[model samples]
Target: MCDMGQWKQSQHFFEHLLNDSNNNNEDLAKVECSLGEVLQWTGEWSEARKYYNRAYDRMMNIKPTRIKDLAYILFNIGEILYLEGKYEEARDYYERALAMQKETYSS
Candidate 1:
C-alpha cells in the first residue's frame, strides 16, 4: 500500500479511511497524507494539495508529537508546488518541512 506505483488502491483505502466517521484525527491525518502522496504521484496536483492541506489541518489539531506528520505533508505540498512551477513557494515549504524533519530526528 505504500507503493505509489499502485496508487489506485492506495487512493481507495485512504478515501475510505477519510470517510470513516469513527476515525480519529491522527488516523485521518495519516491516511490523508498517504492519499496526498498517491494523488501527487498520479499528477493530480490540486487534489494532492487538498489532501495535504486536510492532513496538515488534522495534524495541527493533535499533539506536538504529530508535527512530524505535518512535516511530511508539507513536503508533499512542496512537491506539488514545485510541479506547478511555484519554485519560491515550493522552496519555502521544502525548507519548513526539512527543518521540522531535522527537529523531529534530533529529538
Candidate 2:
C-alpha cells in the first residue's frame, strides 16, 4: 500500500494489523513503525512520533537488537523532529542514527 502511494490505505491496513492480537512483538513493532511512516507521509508529525517512539521502545526491548532497523527508526524520528522545527532534538536523534548506521555498515 505504501509503496503504491496509497497513504490512507496503508495507514488503515497498519492500524488493522496493530489491532490484531495474533502478531508477535517483533512483528507488531514493524507494523507500528510502518504506520508511523504512513502518518509521516500524511504530515501528522505528532501522531507519527507517537507510533515511532512506541515502535522504537518495543524494538529496543527485543534481544539481539536489530541495529539497522533501529537506525532507520531513529532517522525517521529525527526527520519528524526536524519537520517540527526541533533542530536540536532532531540533531540528537540523527546523530544517534548516524552512529548506529556507521557502526552497522562499517563492519
Candidate 3:
C-alpha cells in the first residue's frame, strides 16, 4: 500500500494493525514506524514525530535492540525536523543515525 503511494490506505492498515491484540512490542514498534512514515509523507510533521517517538521508545524496550531500525526511525525523525525548520535538531538526529549506521555497517 505504501509503495503504491496509497497514504490513506497505508495509514488505515497500519492503524488497524496497531490496535490488534496479537501485536507484540516489536510488531507494534514496526507498525508505529510505518504509520509515522505515512504521516510524514503526508506532511504531518508533529503527528509523525509523535509516532516516531513511540516507535523509538518501543524499539528501545526490546531485547538486543535493533540498531538498524533505530537508525531508520532516527533518520526519519530528523527529516521531519528538517521539514519543520529545526535545522540544528535535525542535524543532531541525522548525525546520530549516521553514526549508528556507520558503526553497524563497519563492524
Candidate 4:
C-alpha cells in the first residue's frame, strides 16, 4: 500500500490494524512508523514526528530491544529535518543513528 504512494489508503489500513490489535506492541510500532512515513511524504513534518516519537516510545517498552529499528526511525526523522532545512538537528539525528548502527553491527 505504501510502496505504491497511496498514503491515505496506507494510513487507513495501518490505523485499522492498530485498532484491531490488542497489546501488540510490535504492530503498534510498525503502524506508527508507516503512518509517520506517510505524513512525512505529505509534508506534515510535525505530525510525522509525533507519530515517530510514539513509535520510538513504544519500541522502548518492547523486550530485547532492536537497535536497528530505533536507528531506522531516527534516520527517517533526520531525513525529515534535513528536508525542512534544520541541518544541525538533522545532523544530530543522523549521527545518533549512525552511532547506533555501528554499535549494532560492530559486534
Candidate 5:
C-alpha cells in the first residue's frame, strides 16, 4: 500500500496503526516512518515531520538492530532537512546516514 505511490492511503493506514494503542508493535513505528517519507514526497513537511518524529522516538527507544533501516530513515531525514533549506543540519544527517551505510557494508 505504501510503496505504490498511494500517499493518502499510506498515510491513513499508518495513522491508524500508530493510534491503535499497541505500544509494543514495532511494525506500526516502521509504517509511520514510511508514511512520513510519503508525506515528504508530497511536500507536506509539517505533517511529515510529525510522523517522522513519532517514528524517531519509537526507533530511539527500540534501537533497531537493522542498520539498513536506520540508515534509510536517517537519509530520509537528511533529505527532508535539505528540502527545508536547513543545509548544515541536513549535511549532518546525510553524513550520519552515509557513515551508517559505510559501517554496515564494511562489516
Candidate 6:
C-alpha cells in the first residue's frame, strides 16, 4: 500500500494499531516500523527516522532481541541517510546492520 502511495492509509492503520491499549512493545515496534516505511516512501526522511528510532529504542528493551528486524530498521535508516547525502552517517548504520545480519545468519 505504501509503495502505491497509500501513505495516509497505511499511516492511519499503523497509528491505530499503535494506539491499542493491549498492544505490547513488539507490536508497537512493528507499527512504528511500518509508519517509518510509509513516511520513507513518501519522502519524509526526517519523520521516517523519528519513527524508526522509536522502534529501535523500543526493541532495545525487548528480551531475546530480534536481530533481523533490528537490521531491517537500521538498513532503512541508512537508506534515508544515503538519500540525504550523509554518506558517513549512512555507512555507520549500514555497517551495524551488516554485522547484525551476519550474526543472524552465522549463528
Which number leads on TM-score? Answer: 3
Clashing pairs in 6: none
- What's each prediction's clash count? 0, 0, 0, 0, 0, 0
Error of 5 at 94 (Å): 0.4
Sort every candidate by lDDT, greatest first: 3, 2, 6, 4, 1, 5
lDDT of each: 0.87, 0.94, 0.96, 0.90, 0.79, 0.94
**Candidate with better TM-score, 1 vs 5:** 1
lDDT of each residue in 1-107, candidate 2, tens digit only? 78899999899899999999999989999999999999999999899999999999999988988898899999999999999899999999999999999999899
The TM-score of candidate 5 is: 0.82
Q: Which lDDT tens digits does candidate 4 get at residues 18-85?
A: 68848489778988998899899888999899999999999888888878999999999999999999
Ten contiguous residues minimizing lDDT sum, candidate 1: 1-10
Model 4 pairs in collision: none
The candidate, 4 or 6, that scores higher on lDDT is 6
- The candidate, 3 or 4, that scores higher on lDDT is 3
Superposed on all Cα atoms, the candidates' RMSDs to the truth, in angstroms, are: 1.7, 1.0, 0.7, 1.1, 2.1, 1.0
Question: What lDDT is obtained when candidate 1 is compared to the true structure?
Answer: 0.87
Candidate 1 has a TM-score of: 0.89
Q: Write the per-residue lDDT of candidate 3 for residues 1-107, one digit (tens) a residue.
A: 89999999999999999989999999999999999999999998899999999999999999997999999999999999999899999999999999999989999
Q: Report the C-alpha lDDT of model 1 over 23-80, residue by residue, as the tens digit.
A: 9888888888888888888899899899889889888989756767788888889989
The residue-by-residue lDDT of candidate 5 on 1-107, one tens digit each, is 65688878877877777777765746766877878888998899887877777776677667556667777788888888899999999999889889989999998
Q: How big is the positional error of residue 61 in model 4, measured in Å on the Cα after superposition?
A: 1.5
TM-scores, all models, native as reference: 0.89, 0.95, 0.96, 0.93, 0.82, 0.95
Task: Locate the minimum summed-lDDT window of 10 residues in model 3.
Answer: 41-50
